[model samples]
Target: MRSLLFGVIAITILGLTSCQESAKKTPEFYKDTVTFDLLSDMKSLLDENADKITIDDVNNLNGAIRYYSPIKDSLIGKTIGELIEGQKQRTLSTNINLTQATAFSTLFTQSLKFNISEFQKIEQENGQPLNVPTYQFQNISGKSIVKLSGVVDYYNGEQLIKRFTIEIDKEIPADKTLNQPYPYNHDAKNQRDVFVRDNFDKLRKVWIPTMIEFADGKIYKRNPDKKGENQLDKDAK
Candidate 1:
């Protein structure tokens, strides 16, 4: 009887020891493995949620254009093409782009709250034992800028082990008035007002395409011709 009791106790101790060792070997976070693809996961998350938020700064720009009332959109049937083009240039000016991207990032992360519970569906699809989420932005401007807030999660399979909060802010331009919705240089009845109302759709057209191209890593050294050829014809003068 004494021998049997001792044997039972030894078995129990070995079982407990085995469980402890297993726990140790199991990674608590996905980052423990070098095989993790953090960037891809983050890109997925951002792409999935890109359109969910109606960005206020963008809305403000739209509002400014809307407030100007009805616009003819063309000067004597020639299309106020120059004015439309100018607005696009100013709207996407390098400085303004940086500022807008910074503001957007700040707003997006604030709303996201860095909550892991919100990402359960994503984790399951990606495989789990999630590490913290993270992200990187390529072109931090234009319509595709909407996809810049990449909240990435690491996953082993269906189990969330870890999550990282993606946070980024670009430097605002030194010029305080660069991207202001209302420019002091222009009055209520100014060319700025006229241009916006006339070219409301134009803004979306010119702005969105450039950004989409940039996001896709398509950089145009110069404007392409009808055949989409960038190289100029050497035979031509």
Candidate 2:
């Protein structure tokens, strides 16, 4: 099927590392497989509010957008208004807009576009010592309206942290054959643009973590605050 997602955004997957000695002691919570059936939820939501609501009906539609920081000479942060303003002001070139816009509400009701789970482990960082394994879902389809991307966070030797989805892109071609789940016309001028910017941090804070199961038979349940920030040693537990 031609994916509802118009384009594929490639995220660099880090190479695999040998299962460390600490990894051998992986927690019992992560021993079993867990899955978050977002497709089912999306379907339920669509069915419940069929012909009734748009993306505006729901609340807390958290998301972010990548933009180049002229001062730093790099793409440093995600902000919708800043990005738009930068483009409008001619300070940033329009050729740089990589992905479209995504709203969290519309993302919750779509099916994944393609197979994307070959690698899931993220290498340990400085402050966050434990290697984190993540499950991701991208380029969803359904209703032919909105597409979304997803990530599920899991600790190396503990439980999960967050399972959330974000919008894929702002602009979607008008499909008269397809049902428009959201009231807005995605093809309209600046209609799909972000209304409020600078909410990326707020989105992270307000996002409620959920449980998820991977096809590989590993289950993950959210364990918020189990380990303090910058706590690294897995054996100390």
Candidate 3:
């Protein structure tokens, strides 16, 4: 079965190391899996909205693409500017003019997507120090905070199917000098591409496995056979 990886974006987008002593992952935790029952749960949503706006729904894409100097490369006229066709230093902004467009109001009644655990531990990059995003979601919600910078896997019975991973560090929440209250960053989205369908497709393929290292120091491979296999088979047939 294909997953939409609802929370998979915006977090786990970066890679790093060593902010704390590695904690041993619980054997059962490795057992507690991350699975999406979207076909069953989200069917209504897809049915209602999937067709209303297909990828071709994109009408026009407008934005500025700019190139800037690195933190160290300020002067030298290397400061950078608007991008040219194939400039050594460039930022390209191609406007996509589609025939149709989709509206945001459609999701009001259709929110079908997998959840991440909130009381659940958010996976920090292997070793980056913790910083507050200044935003807050009730850690108690058990809503999964999808790891943006990771790989996601799809399983069917005992079979491991197709997979891919992408980093969302660019979207990962950063530590803030100030903190906001709950539901602050939840559902926050910024449009990048003309059709978000392409972005969603990329996210669905990533395997955002939970971070539960064993006492022996090996990583946990999220096995879907135990629970999600039934759903996989149901969807497949």
**Predicted structure with the largest TM-score when compared to the true one:** 2
Better of 1 and 3 by lDDT: 1
Candidate 3 — what's its lDDT?
0.25
Model 2: which ten-residue window has the lowest total lDDT?
Answer: 191-200
Predicted candidate 2 versus true structure: per-residue lDDT over 53-107, tens digit per residue = 3332222111111223233523233232333334444422322221111222222
Question: For candidate 1, what is the TM-score?
Answer: 0.16
- Cα-based lDDT at residue 221, candidate 2: 34
Q: Which stretches of candidate 2 lie over 4 Å from their true place?
A: 1-110, 113-141, 145-151, 161-167, 170-237
Query: Residues 2-85, candidate 1, lDDT per residue (tens digit)?
Result: 999999999999999998786555222212211125223534533454453224433432343343326543222221223233
Question: Candidate 2: global Cα-lDDT?
Answer: 0.28
Quick one: best lDDT, which candidate? 1
Off by over 4 Å in 1: 26-37, 42-237
**How high is the CA lDDT of each candidate model?**
0.33, 0.28, 0.25
> Where does model 3 exceed 4 Å of error?
1-147, 172-207, 210-237
Return the candidate ranking by lDDT, descending: 1, 2, 3
In angstroms, how far off is 166's CA in candidate 2?
A: 4.8
